[model samples]
Target: MARKTSLKDIANKVGVSTSLVSYVLNNKDKENRVGKETADKIRKAAKELNYFPNLNARSLKTNISHTIGLIVADISNPFFSSLARTIEDEAYARNYTVIFGSSDENNDKFIKVLDFLSTRQVDGFIVASPEESRETVLGLKESNVPLVLIDRYFSDIVVNTVMVDNFKASFEATNHLLNKGHKRIGAIVYESTLLHYQDRCNGYLEAMKQAGIVDGTQFLAKVNHQSLQTEIQEAVQKLIFEDKVTAIYFSTNTIATEGLKQIKNVGKKIQEEIDVVAFDENLIFQFLDVHVPFVSQPIKKMGQEAVRILIDQIENKDQGIINVLLKATLETKEKLQKVN
Candidate 1:
């Protein structure tokens, strides 16, 4: 490997005093009266030597790491992964490095990652507050950690939060099916014990009742992550076979994907026979055998905005809590006329 170069070597090569070089490199020369030509030469020489500033040591003097931590419920989900990449890119543009951690939807792992990142001297944080970690939300306020919650919100906690309007989004999706003449619409949701999951289910019920469907079973179906397909297949099968559900609405991308698979397995002809709509976005929906209506959440925009909020809170030390509700867009590839 080539020898590592230092500021002293660059100063000697550029024929300038080390103090002058330091002043120029640190941008302190504007007040020190150092000539710009000498500063330019020092910069050129440092570049040729591939000299990198010691940010770690410099951060110690300023008491700011210029870094942020991003924690999510699950990194495997494309929505979260896309959000992470967007946030990382935005943070990079702001000269901030972002570290990521996944909570795995477990309180233990959530607390562990929160504790681990807290020790890193991160300037701020962007967190997806999982439902099981409500107390953690309360504790964050006391820790003086600048925070922005993404994809979910706590009604009781005062904090900066950015997320799609889960209730409105799900409600609109169900309303779309109802407008398409779907009466016996079933909904599939995935959540262990989170309130946001409950919100989606509630939205489905509200929409069903507003459409005059009083029966309860058609409005609710809960599934775990691993048994997504099995649960969807069983629930949808019952809706088709026993409950006489002519349509279904999924509350997430994962559930939507499974719902499509179950519908296809039962028979592709069923697509023309029944109506379907889902809360989240997925590529599968884009190419489904028949055009099914679905709701699109702006995942990338949410990620970018969350980082901006976190940075603002960190720099301004403003404790004002904000709840930004982004609207969801609805898409339908096939125009199925209202049948109800």
Candidate 2:
């Protein structure tokens, strides 16, 4: 293989000292009082020589790897996949790289990924924590590792977090169904201890209460995340046949997809036999013959804010903790038509 180009080669081509080239290439020319013309010359020569700085060496010197670790519940889920894409774009714009991992809602897997990323010397983390991860999150905080929780966070943990107001979103969606004469509406949510899921469940219950509908538990169904396919189908059966709900509210896109599939299997059509509202938007929802209104979270904003807060914490360790709860909007093409 041909020899790798080095800073020395660029310096020699530009007729400058290696140190001067280093300062210019590392964007320290202003502080070092290097002339702009000379800095330009060094940059031009470095480009001509195809010089690429050794990130490992620079990291060793500055103690910054310029890498971020991102942990999500499931990368295959559309919400997380979209969030990850937005995070990648935002991090790239800020000159940082991201390493991604999926926890699959398993705390053990989450810890393993965290350890692997820590060993790789990532500068910080943006995580959508799974259930029973309070201790793991607290440990990271105690260790002074820069972290920002997204999508979900502990209510008592004091840390940087950026997430949507899930309770408000769910409340509005449930109320929308209620406004359409859906008194016996049901909700399907994950049976997890994560605060976000709990907030969503509470939102649905509160909306039902406000509508003068007592006994919300009769219409609410919780499914195990590990067995979503089977459990979601069972929940749909219970809600539709047993509870005799005319409408259903799904807490997440994944749940909504599976629930919709189960609805189809039972020969029910959306807005015809039953009205449906879901927490997050899915591409498939738009293509269905009927409209499925959903709560739209500001995904791009969430990702950008998470990266911003995490990077800020990484750079300024003394900065105060930040907790941001963004608002989600309910998107509907038209008013819900009550099923007879």
Candidate 3:
């Protein structure tokens, strides 16, 4: 086997700039920047010479590491894991590599990770949690770094973002339980710096208010992220035994799973004594003898669009503060068997 032909080969054969050849081949010539005749000539030369993008060589020439830095709140959480997987695949498809890390929702830890990845000269960043790193993000923006925020973002700063409508999704999910005649519902969520969680908590509050439930905000249980495992179980117990909530809404999968464990420990059956609703669904949840209605986000689409925007920012310097809000669906389990 022979070494594959490179972009430079095609550029040399077509008498065009290597930059022009790259833009055309990467489909980044969105504004028809390259004339049709010139694009055709480049393509013809590439095909004739069997030229392929030498990503490594191009990285050296363009001063791009061909790598992206992905910082999530916590990779152990299923949502972040799934999001990272999708982003990694999408970045690789665009001829880029991804270096991922978990921030554990700590601003200091997040800053360290960003510093490490930045030193590697990664071309861009796709951040899932920027709630605590607002200043750091602003610095990166000022430095002309390409960035795309997912999951959560800062409202004060203008940044490219891809997020689900958390307020609307949480409102609909809570209303789903309320519509089922569960007037007094409890919500278990970690109290964090993420703006999305605040929106979710408010959504639940709004639903309770709409149902004419008095002191509706009282049912919202916000726990510390560091002490969530203990705090969540205590909160669940309080809602069930003391407050006598007829239903519970978990704002994230971490809360949902822990809430379920608490419910089971207290010997309660879902949809019998109380109903349950959560933000994200997992395969293991399906096997549980419980009816769990969940809000499903378009994770893959979010990842693809974020990567596309970041690449655009890198190639064309087009960082015009794009805010893409995607819709989430409320999936209800209509059929659930009762456990004896």
Evaluate all candidate structures by whole-model CA lDDT and list the values in order. 0.76, 0.87, 0.81
What tens-digit string does per-residue lDDT give for candidate 2 at 228-326?
999999999989999999999999998999999999999888777888999998889878988899999999999999999989887887889999999
Of the pair 1 and 3, which is ahead by lDDT? 3
Candidate 1 clashing pairs, residues 3+ apart or interchain: 180-338, 181-339, 181-340
What would the per-residue lDDT of candidate 1 be over residues 1-340, giving only the tens digit for each residue? 3445677998889888889888876767778988888778887787677554443344345566778989998898778888899999999999999988999777657766765675576777798876578766666654567888888777777788897877777888888888888787888888556666777788888888887887655457778876677778897787777777788888888788888888778774545676778776777766755676678878778988888888887777754776788988888766657673
Off by over 4 Å in 1: 1-62, 268-270
lDDT of 3 by residue, 1-340 (tens): 3556677888889998889988787666656578888988987886577454333333344576678989998888878888999999998899999998888877667766776676566788898764467766665555567888888888887889999999999999998887776777899876777788888988888888888985787888889877878998899899999999988999988788888888888899877787899999876597887668899999998999999998888777745778899999998858534323
Any idea how many clashes model 1 has? 3
Q: Name the better of 2 and 3 by lDDT.
A: 2
Clashes of each: 3, 0, 0
- lDDT score for candidate 1 against the true structure: 0.76
Candidate 2, backbone clash total: 0
Top lDDT prediction, candidate number: 2
